[model samples]
Target: MNGRFVRLGETGRARVAIVIDGQAVDALEGDTLITAMLCSVRHVRQSEFGEEKRAGYCLMGACQDCWVWTDEGERLRACTTVVEPGMRILTTQPEAQWATLAL
Candidate 1:
C-alpha cells in the first residue's frame, strides 16, 4: 500500500465501488469516481464522437470535459464531486445538451 493509504485521516479515503463501462470497480478511499475511471485508462473523458484525447479542464466544476453519466441518468462534473458507494459512472461521450451556451 502507498504511504498515503496507510495514513488516511478522518477525512480518510474509503473504498467506494463504481461501475465503469459496465464493470464494477472499487476506488480509493475519498477518491472521486473520475479518479477511478482514470485508473482504467489514462484519459477518462470521452466525447460522443469518441475522441481519444479528451480531458477535464476546470476540475473545480467549471469545465465540461469531466462530465460523466451517473446511474441515475443525470450528467455531472467529476472533479468537484466525490465518489460514493455503488456509483455507476460511465466516463464516456459528450452530453446531449449544454446547460450554458457560450458564443
Candidate 2:
C-alpha cells in the first residue's frame, strides 16, 4: 500500500520488520514509530472521537496526537518511540471481550 510520507533519502539503513494492524511493514533501523508508521501507512491511527484519522500534530512528543497501542493494550507515543523488530502495533484499540455482554 502507498504511504502518506514518501522516503526521499536515507534509504540504505537496515530494515526492521513490524506488524501494523496485522499487516507487515518494513521500517528503517533507528526510526521513530511515527516515522516508521507514516512511511508505511496513510494515517497513523483513527481518532477516538470520530471516524477522522490522525497523522500527528507535533512531530515531537509534546502532543498527544501520536498515541498508539500495542496488541497487548499498552499505550505508546509514536513520535518518541523507536520501531523494534517483530513489534506488533495496533492502530485501533482492542475491544474488551466483555464489552458486548449485558450487565
Q: Against the true structure, whose lDDT is highest?
A: 2
Residue-pair clashes, model 1: 6
Return the TM-score for each candidate structure: 0.63, 0.90
Q: Which pairs clash inside model 2? A: none
Error of 2 at 46 (Å): 0.9
Q: What is the C-alpha lDDT of each candidate?
A: 0.62, 0.89
Angstrom error at residue 79, model 1: 0.5
- Per the 3 Å backbone cut-off, how many clashing residue pairs does candidate 2 have? 0
Candidate 2 per-residue C-alpha lDDT over 1-103 given as tens digits, one digit per residue, 9 for 90 to 100: 6798999999999999999989999999999999999999998988877778899999899979998899888999999999999999988755532354534
Q: Model 1, range 1-103, lDDT digits (tens) per residue?
A: 1111222344445667777657776677777655556655455556766456555665566666787777566787777678778887666542433322332
